[model samples]
Target: MKELDCLFVYPGAPAGKKNLLPIMPAGLLAMAAYLERNSVSAAIISLPSALDGEFDLPGIIRERRVKLVCIPAHWHRQAGGALRLAEQLKRAVPGVRIALGGYTASRFAAEILKEHPAVDFVVRGDGELPLLKLLGSLGTGGRSLGRVPNLAWRGKEGVTLNRTSYAAGSATLTGLGLAGLRFVLNRRLTPRRGICFEDGMFTYVQARGCADNCSACGGGRDAQRRMCGRRGVALKSPASVVRDFAELAAMGIKEIQLPLNPLPSDAYYIALLKLLMKKKLRPVLKIELCGLPSGKLLKWLGRALGPESKITIFAGSGSEKIRRLNRGRFYTNAGLMAALRLASRLGVKAWTAFTTGLPFETRRDFLATAALVRRMRREFKIGRSGVYVFSLEPGSPLFEDPEKYGVTLRRRTLKDFLAQRGKYDMGYSTACFTEREIVRNLKFLEKTAR
Candidate 1:
């Protein structure tokens, strides 16, 4: 048995998405690395696998003997589960300090602190420095409570709050250091039945924050700066990102997923691809494009990753109208199809996401979207497609001003969300679609995909 100070927990949200296979806790991985870099011994736990009876977490906690447990609540979908996991851990290891961090947790810190007694601390913004300080001050009997920044703690004078920074400048990818992906490769993390790729795939990040303003997404540019205190999108060097991938390849992780924002510069992307081409990375890389790509970029991607390397595009919605409303202002269905057409020609796989009953979505538009999805699958010959029900996110423009978009926003209160069956689930709770319509569309999507 080893004595440890902290253990990071990845609270999985299986019910939120139709397919949770690709939902890796990449942020927790990065944060773990950050902690390790600060000379703290840490390990990440999976709440999903634990719930599914894959491992004995209570036993593991006793064996490891950690003083503090940090469960990251980045996605709102995973927040409730994360809180529940924290409560369970507290009960298992009595007196073990519990904390939560990441986007969702930061956005809703006040209410979470008021509600969850098991959560001793909540990291409000940039987590690296604050977490490092918190760990250093742990076991000191409240001697250093005020020193830790961006922390909400259960103080003697009620919940004591500290200065929290929202700027990406305060905490950047470069500052957090390496992607601690290998930590998740443990057999304990594997479910009885998981995706085959889960056994080998590794997730990495190139940037923090996004510049686009997708109406329904809370991580949009405006939302980030206004609510999250994240200013500009902080990017890491291509050399740094490529170096990490190369290291992963050497470590026997051939399939690397770079879940980055659309790279800030095309030249940077070209350079990254060129560097990747030079390395001995036999990688099946998955990248989420912010928008449709140009022919040149597609050619660059083809040259960088040969036919052996599988590519998966994260394009959501094949309908132009839905794209404008939810995805971004610039990208169109035609542009997306063009990229897929190029991808098909280059022998690469792509994924186009779909949302039924969006704001201003007529039955005609839904039909058009369905038709386009079918066309992408059969005609353009893209790899795969997915469909989902549209629900307003807490931080998105659509959530703030539902009337403007012809959509009614539900789940405004923390109580509403906590009470919901699938709190952060992207179920059809929008004014645009009835619950029946959502269920029917879900069935239709399943049928089409089959």
Candidate 2:
């Protein structure tokens, strides 16, 4: 058997709305592409699929002759499992270099490396390129590790750190060579089982990072700039945006998901939609656009994509008070009303999404969101739009300081959330919010949706 050069391990997290379908982690996919581009053979193994824990990872590595093991740690939820997996990989392949990279890797680098001695190198920030360089350097006779940026390692003396540099500028979506990625994952990354959409599965990004200053959001303003060392939203060039969709269509990927934060400009979105139409991509081209559309924006989208176009609007709250707290300035009830009104008139399938139990939220606040959702459904006949309860996301400000908003961190840690065995999975848990208020508000929202 041919020796496997590298084994890229994609750590899993609990999935589903009620615990629903597996979301392909784009970061791991992107890194896979980068490694393959540099002539490194990489295989992605998703731990979530090993639910019964039947997969013999050590035996597999031995069979495949694996060399390097790279695992990405996401927030607190996957950190423990990912770190454990890293230790296992180290034990399985003593010569194999184990590395950790991801959002949490960058945010809590010092602490993670100190705690996880199994991790030989910590790839901080956007790790694709640095990881590629590191792998290439290792492939040859041992070379000085001085060139690779965002690398943290411990030596004979002590720990050594390198300069911070990203795989590429976070702004350029075109920099992400999807055409290249699709080729590598063609064999390894089979279509995700039980996704929301069937026969169409592609995830593309129109923009990287966010501009919102929400103190709770991990990628909000200051944090984003500090993390990426840039200001404002960085979008993929319009042509690159369109090309990605077109490529997916060519590959028989019918539904393309664009998870752009803060959304992209009207012109960029319109241009990309027009390009997709030119290629004749079919029903349900999904995108997590940053807020409710504006009246003018809705009109433009409707005209450009036709009534059959489906778009999910992520409006976290209906109450102005709650919106103010989340720093969700993109939409107000008035703005949302206008957007929904236009969508209804144009015959577009628009879904209004809201989350409950925000920091500083009260019973009145919950009622406000429920009432607003009910009104939207009634007024616009937007039956498909509904409210989603809040879950604690570590990178968000809500997790950073839960107490400030009159909530207590009941779950305590990631382990507690993981050990849960009931209908309510981590996705729906309000670890910080009181259970009574959360249950009451969620019931109200569900009733209103019905």
lDDT score, candidate 1: 0.67
Give the lDDT of residue 350 in candidate 2.
Answer: 79
**lDDT values of the candidates?**
0.67, 0.63
lDDT of 1 by residue, 188-307 (tens): 543432212353555566776787877677777877765556777777777777877776666666676666454434675677888777774547777666666677767877777756
Off by over 4 Å in 1: 11-24, 47-65, 166-172, 175-200, 260-265, 308-317, 381-384, 390-392, 422-428, 445-450
Best by TM-score: 1
Q: List clashing residue pairs in candidate 1.
A: 166-229, 317-353
Which structure among the candidates has the greatest lDDT?
Answer: 1
Model 2 regions more than 4 Å off: 14-21, 47-60, 63-65, 137-143, 156-161, 170-172, 180-190, 194-201, 226-232, 278-283, 306-308, 382-384, 401-436
Question: What TM-score should be assigned to candidate 1?
Answer: 0.84
